[model samples]
Structure formats: C-alpha cells, structure tokens
Target: MNDKENRSRSRNETSTRTGMGASRPSRRIVAGHTRPCAECGLVDWKLDDSRGEVSCNSCGLVVEENVIDPGAEWTNHANTGVDRSRVGAPITHTLADKGLNTSIAASDLTSGGASRNGISARSRREWRRRRVIDERSKTRQSKIRNRVKAFQYIRDRSQLPSSLKEEACRIYGMLSDEGFVTGRSIAGVTAACTYLVARKEGIPRQIPDLAEKFHVGEKELSRLIRGVSRRFNMHTITLPPQFFPKFVSDLELPPETMMALDGLWNTIEPHTDIWQGKKPMGVAAALIYKAAAEGGTRRTQSDICKVANVSEVTLRGLIKQIDGLLKSIGSPSA
Candidate 1:
C-alpha cells in the first residue's frame, strides 16, 4: 500500500478502537448518577427510598432495583408501635421555651426508671436541685416568664382550639417585639389575638365573647385587635353569610328554618349594599327572624334579637329591607 493510504487506515483503526467512530452512542459513567431505562429508553427516573429502586416515570419500569439507601435508619412515623423517631417533639410557639426545653419529671424514679431511693441521698438531692434549676432557668428572663404567664392565662380562659392558640401566641410574639405589649395588659393582647385568629379562621367567635371570657373590657380588646392588625398589616375580610347556617344550628333552630335562612342569605349576598356597613351578627339575626316568620316557625323577634345581641329596632329595620328586596325580586319573603 501507499504511505498515505497506510496512515489513513491506521488512523481509522485507532478511531474504531477508541470508540470515537462507533455507530452507537457511548454511555458515560458518573458517580451517583442515573441513566435511561433499558426497557422504555426513558431518562426520567425516580429514586424510591422505601423500596430502594430506581423506576421509570413514564412506563413504571424498574430500572435498577434494590439499591442500598444511605439515609437515616429511623423514621418520624411508623405503622407499628410508637414512632421510634430519635427526634424530639416538633417545635411549637405556644410554649414560652418554643417547646425545645427538656422537662424533668417529678417522679420518685430517675429518668431511666431506676429507683431514686436505691441511689445515694446525695444523688437524689442533686437531681432535685437540677430539676429546680431547670424550672428556674425558664423564668430567669422576664420576657419568657411573661410569655409563660400570658400563655397560661389564654389556656385557662379561652376555649380556642390548639391551632388557634398557637396562632394567638405567634401574634402576641409579634406584638411584643413591636413594643405593643409594653403597657397593654397581656390578657388583653392574648384575648385580642385569639379573637383575630378565630375570626380569620372563620370560626364563630365575637369580640365581646372573647372579652367576657378573658375578663377584659370590650374597648380594650378592640384597641389591641386594631393595633395588632395595623402593625401586622393584616386585613381580614368579613365572615361570609354562609357561616350563619352553622351558627343558627347551635340555637336549636329547625332544619327548615335554617334552609330558609340559607336561601335568604344567598339571595342577598350579591346585593351587598343592603347589609353593607352593618354589623353582620345583627343582619344575620334579622334574617333568621324573617326566615322563621316566613317558614311558619314560632321564634319571636325578641328571642332572636337577644340571641344575636342586637336591638329589636335594628332587627326590624333589617327585616323590612330584606322583605322589600324579596318583593322587588318577585320572590316570597324568606
């Protein structure tokens, strides 16, 4: 062969051996890498921690089955027995310590359940001293001590749910940071926070209800609510009229009466001009009275007005407006 032809043949042979001239694409090797599924040729693969398998997302093909997982050995929750998680309880803002502080049980036995009396009296005394120290440590800071007291008062007085209580605590924390709680009564702020959270959550709690429960004046509660709301720039919308159904049910009203009231509220909902700028509770009371009267139920206007904490005059005015609107729409009252 000629010298040029011989060099060309050698170059081609070297390219083939090094896979540079191969017809098929070469696979790249990488540490902790994923490749396309052999069965479906799909590149999207998910690592299943429970089964330790790499599966195709498109075809559900098991690409690489039974991989060893190098994650933690424990889980937060399990179907069997108690959760054997090595982690502690989740952090909560409701507690003064943010639920991170360790609590020492006041039992006769040690933390490991060993008999305390079996140990030396000196050790028992030391444990007691440590417990006292731990408790006193929580109160060393005036802010923490005040938070503890405020939270306790909220717990004792408010009948709020746990989530609402936590939210109230968070709101109070913000208020304290802004110095809003410096001169204000802790009870008032706590009550106002609870009320605000309940209202935001669509729970049927009134400001006066919270004030009465927490033994704070309604004006003070209102002031705190306004201050916290403005400081946080929180604009809570008014509760929907649909909330009245669940509320009226608490009064032991008949199902038919509730149905009528629901219909009335739905009809008047779009016409916000009628009930706008009025107390929702008073409007709801009037609607219930009108619905009851139209539904042939015997609930007196006075009974509903008292239940709604509205005056008879206000109730009558709303009833008249609703009646006129219904008549204008060519619908029967209720």
Candidate 2:
C-alpha cells in the first residue's frame, strides 16, 4: 500500500475508535450473562477490566483476583456464600411466566437507591439486623415505663382517713427508686396501696374482692396488709358477742372487783330465801353494799324499799347483813 494511503487509513481507524468525549472510555456494555460465585452465592457478575477482580454484589466478596474462566465448581466451595465474582451474570431481572420478578433485588422497591441492586442489597441486610436490636431496646424501655406509671396510678388512687396521699407518694418513691425496676405491676401496687389506706383509716375491705380487683393472690395481699400495719403501728382487734369481759379486762380492774360485780347480784338472789316480807331485794342489796364500801349513796334504803315493794324492816335487815359480810370479808374497799 502507498504511504499516503496507509496514513489516511490509520487516521480513519483512530477517529472511528475515539468516543464523543476525547479520550474517555465508552459506557460499560453488559453481556447479559450470569454465573453463581463459588465463594459467595451471588448469581450476578459485572466485569471490571482494570483490576482483574470479580466482585459479587450480593455478599461483596472478591471471587477472582487474577484468574480467567474462574473454574467450574467455583460455586461449590466453603466460600460460595461469600464470593464477590463479577462475571457472566444477567444484568437485569426478568419476570417468569407468572409475571412476577421474584428477584433478589426486592430491597430496591423499599429503598430507591442509585445503584438500585447493589445498595439496596447491602442496606436491607444491615437495616434488618439493626431493626431487630432496636425493637428489643424499645420493648425493654416500654416495660420499664409502664411499671413506673402503674405505681403512680396507685399512689393517686389511694384513699386513707389521714394524710394517706402523702404516705402513698412516699411509698411509691421508695419502691420506684430503691426497689427493683420492674419488680411490681400496676394491679399489685394498687392492691397494696388500697389495703394500706384502709388499714390506716380503720376501714375494713373484703380481702377476696381486693385481691381480685388488684390481680393479686390472697397470700400476697395478706403480706402487704401486714407490712402496712407494721409500718403504721396500728392495732387491730375483733370484738366477740360477749364483749363485756374484754372491756372489763382492758380496764385493768382488780380480779376480785370483777368477780364481785359479776356474782354480787346472783348471791343476793339465793339469800332471798331467808328474807321475809316483800323486799326490794335487788336494789336494796346493790345500794347498801355500794354505800358502805364506796362511802357514798345516791339512794337510801327507804327509797329502795319503796321501789322494790319491800317493807323497811326487811330492807334494813338485808342491808345490815350485807354490811356485816363485807366487813368480815375484809374487802379492799372496806
């Protein structure tokens, strides 16, 4: 070929190869081929000619550093799930006969990224792991807050005759600040506070009802009741039908005095057999004995005789005998 002709041919060839922008390389053309990585399980591969590296976009592991054809069972090794091979993979997702993409790039739909496939894949996995940790932390915080609010409710609702509100606030503070964080529930706390208030004010609430409403067992409620009672130094007492005995005992009366008050009338009744005329037996006995011992008389034997329909003689005789018995007995008052 002539020199001129060869030079013209070379110039034409260089111009034909040069892209619009002076020396910039043309956009990458995907070969529409796909192969699973033997190391990582990424089924997509995009070739990077400069570095001779095959990167799997799925797990981001470099599969081939300086090799060709990457070998046949490359997808069958221990690192298959971690391979980053960028070669011989379909560039775009396809719909099956059912018209569903069912592609691994589902993450792209949720998070629209520039590199829709690559960025979405990495972000989805990381976001999922982080979301799980965050959910656990949120649940723990919720439980703690609910427990605190429950105690606050108890303190607000508690009603006692005295400064029960103040007491409740104090108790709630003690429990929340000093006790276990999630130690008690709203129901349990409400029951305890209610019970404490009732005891402090001497109001009697049914135990079973309180237990049911508070969602606490009788045993636990009982414990709380006792604890509050001890804290308040309150005394509880049950009165029987024969409350007179307890009343007298509590008064610290001498044992002999108690006996005299009980048996004096009965003994006088038996002695009535010896009395003659109509007698104000009961009143006459009470008056003479009380007067001689206590050195005071609110009513005379004459009045007793008239009230009892007994003659003065019988009334006086009975009084004299009772007085003599009192002296003989050497009673404390005598």
Candidate 3:
C-alpha cells in the first residue's frame, strides 16, 4: 500500500477504537480492553447492588452510574427486609399439602369493581362446584385429612407460637413415618409432639396445661409423652428454677417481690425436699406467695392459687413445706 493510504487507515482504526479523534489513547482502556478508574488509576471496580453503580472501592468515586441490577428489588427497614419475591409462602410441614396448595375464594365476585367484566350465573355455579371439588381433593387421602384436622386442633387449642406449631407438625410426621402413629390417635400424637416441642424450646407450657387444653387426660398425655420421647430418643430437660422469676412477674408481682423470689429460690434451691416430685409451676407459685407475703404485697392464697392454676390446698401445702425449710435454715418465715 502507499504510505499516505496506510497512515489514513491507521488513523481511522484509532478513531473507531477510541471513539474520539486520534489525538491520544483512551485512559478508560487498559491491556485487552480492561477498564480502569479515571480518578485513582485502579483496575479494581465494585458493583453496588443496592445503588446500581460501578464505583472505585479505594477513592469512593463512581466509575459508572445507572447500572442495571439483575436482582430482586427489596426494601429493608430496621432489622426486617420485605421479600417482594414472586414465590409464595415457604413450604411448611404443618400444612397437609406442605403449603403448596392453592385456595379458591368463595366471596362475592362483584365486590371489587374489577369484576365489571361480569360472569354469568352459570359460571358462578361452576366456580362454586369447582371450589367444593378442590376442597374435597385436599382431603382425598385419609392420612392427609387427619393431619389437617390435627394441625387445626393444635393451632386452635394449643395456643402455641407458629414456630412451635411447625415443629410439632414435623415431629408428628416423623412419628407417622416411623410407624409410631399406627395405633396412636392423631390427637394424642399431636398433643405429645406439641408438649415436647414446647419443653424443647423452653416456652414454659406444662404437660397438664396442654392436657387440659386438649381435653386429654393428664395421665394419658404423660404416657404418650414418655412413649414418644423413648421412640424418638428425645432428651427432655426440666426447666430450671431460674424460670420462676418470669412466672412470678407474670403474676403481676412487684419488682421487689420478684427480687425476693429470686433470693428465696437461691436459698431454697439446694433443698430439693421442698420441690421434689412437685410441679415447677406449683413450686414457683408457692415461692411467689411466700415472697409476696414477706414483702407485704397482700396477695392472698386464693389469688396465688388461681394464677398458678393450683388448688388453694396445694398452695398451702407448698407454702408450709417452704416455710419449714426456711425455718430449718434459720431464715425468717413469711
């Protein structure tokens, strides 16, 4: 080629590559088309997912702005972030269908003005029929139907938190899978699982309380708990005496009464005779009553008994036992 033609071709190539007149090379480019920062001369660039920018990490300068983020847009406040995800509620074992089943609403279709594109009476009837069929289909399997009923009972009757409910449902499923539910009633197994989970999570619900709630005999429920514990190799731990302070506080006792209860627990905890084979709730109630009386809180025996759900007789018995122990230790009695 001629020298003039070669020079023109080189200039054209440089202009195309640099997007500018061929005066100098572009500073944004490096070896093999790598882009470096114009401010700090650094190759390291960070993509800000939140702000949608490519910024220089060292110089706090944005190398490129308005970058598109290929992630879900989310809003976070305080410690919680709202997941505006396309996916629905997470799969949970508590539901018979693991929460994947869709629901058909039976409310008035025209309630919302969007239903101005009205449906005929015949279509409405067909939808109602379809809703019935969907409902029936959910309980097509006997076991699944039983699980649904059991979950409803647990939720309505147990008054447990959702976390404990989910855990109980999981435990029931495990028991059913292991053939532990073959001869056991669904209610019994579910109640046992709920009690176990409450104890495991330290939520403070007692076996007798759950039994009374479910209308199952306390002896029967206790038997089921023991059986389930053995079958699942579950280790049940007794709630410590330290749990009494919360119970005392829940009784609406004053802070001084709570402090007095704490001191009483520390003094009497070494004496198991005072609480041996006794319900922790009863022991806690007795201690609270004693502490309140000592602190001049004017809480009556009947009042303490009602809050603890123990009889007045039991309360007096526990009080007497605690009072004796206090005297033996040379501590003044309430």
> Which residue ranges in model 2 land beyond 4 Å of their true spot?
1-148, 151-166, 180-182, 227-334
lDDT of each: 0.74, 0.48, 0.73
Q: What is the lDDT of residue 104 in candidate 3?
A: 77
**185 in model 2: Cα distance from truth in Å?**
4.1
The digit string of per-residue lDDT tens for model 1 on 268-333 reads 888988888888888888787777777777578777766777789988888889888888888766
Candidate 3 per-residue C-alpha lDDT over 1-334 given as tens digits, one digit per residue, 9 for 90 to 100: 4755754554445435444555654334312325645554445456766676767654667766767655664544354666544466679977877889898776753334225538676677777788889999889887778778887877787777888888888888877767787777777778898888877876667666778778788888889999998887776656336456566666676778767777888888888777868877788888887778788876888877776678888878888888888887898653
What TM-score fits each model?
A: 0.69, 0.25, 0.71
**TM-score of model 1 vs. true structure:** 0.69
lDDT of 2 at 6: 58
Q: Give candidate 2's TM-score.
A: 0.25
Please tell me which model should have the higher TM-score, number 2 or number 3.
Answer: 3
Q: Give the number of the best model, judged by TM-score.
A: 3
Give the alpha carbon lDDT tens digit for every residue of 100-127 in model 2.
Answer: 2222333443566426555566667776
lDDT of 1 at 196: 75
Candidate 1 vs candidate 2: which has greater TM-score?
1
**Cα error of candidate 1 at position 50, Å:** 14
- Looking at candidate 1, the ten consecutive residues that score lowest on lDDT are 24-33
In each prediction, how many residue pairs overlap at the backbone (N, C-alpha, C within less than 3 A)? 0, 21, 0
Lowest-sum lDDT 10-residue window in model 3: 24-33
